[model samples]
Target: MLVKYRGSYEKVAMGLLSFIPDLKDLNNLTNEMTLYQKDESHVLYLWKNKDNDFSGVVGVEVADKYIVVRQISLIPSERGTGNSLEILDELHQLYPDQNMMGSFDTTKLVAKWTEHNRHLNTEV
Candidate 1:
C-alpha cells in the first residue's frame, strides 16, 4: 500500500531512497527529502508491504497537467517482484485525472509500466 510520507518516516524513507544510485549520497538524499517536505508540488509516498513495513519510496512532482515521477526505489528483496509496477499502478489510480509522466531518472521504468498497462487493456 502507498502511504503519504510523514516526518516520522524520515529514516525509513531516506534508507529506501538510498537504494537509488543518485540518492546514495547523503547530501543529495537530504536535499531531495527536504524538497519533498517543503514544496507542495513535490510529494513522497512510502510503500508499506503486506507485513506493514515500508519497503520502498516513490517521489513525484505534481504540475498543472502531469504528475512527474521523480524517483522510485525498492528494497533489494522487493526488486523484480512486481512491487514497483504495483506502486505505479496505485499512483495512477490515486490521480486518475492527471496524466502521469516520468522524470529523467524514472523514464524507462515508467515507460515499461505504461506499456504493461496498455497491453493489459488490449488483452480483451
Candidate 2:
C-alpha cells in the first residue's frame, strides 16, 4: 500500500529513494524530502509490502490540472518484481479524478511503463 511519508520514516524513505541514481547523494535526497514535507503541493508516499515493511517511495507534485510524478524508486529486492508498477497503479487509484503525469525526472520511466501496460487501456 502507498502511505504518506512522515518524519518518522526518514530512514526508510531515504533508503528507498537512494535507489535512484540522481538521489544517491544524501544532501540531494534530503532536499527533495524536505520539499515534500514543507510544500503543500508536493507529496511523498512510502509503499509498504504485504509484510508491512516499507519498500518504495513515490513522490508527486499536485499541479493545477494533474498530478506530476516527480520520483519513484523501489527497494532493490522489489525491483523487477512489478512492484513499481503496482505502486503506480495505486497512485492512479488515489487520484483518479485528475490526470496522472510525469515531470522531467520521471517521464521516461512513466512513459515506458504506461506503454508496456497500454494493453489494459487503463492507468498504469
lDDT of model 2 at position 105: 84
Q: Kindly list the per-residue Cα lDDT of model 1 for residues 1-124, writing each as its tens digit.
A: 9999999999999999999888889999999999999999999999988898899999999887789999999999889999989999999988888888998988999999999999999997
Q: For candidate 2, write residues 46-91 as lDDT tens digits.
A: 9998889998899998877789898898878888887877888898
Best by lDDT: 1
TM-score list, all predictions = 0.96, 0.87
TM-score of 2: 0.87
Clashes of 1: 0
* CA lDDT for candidate 2: 0.86
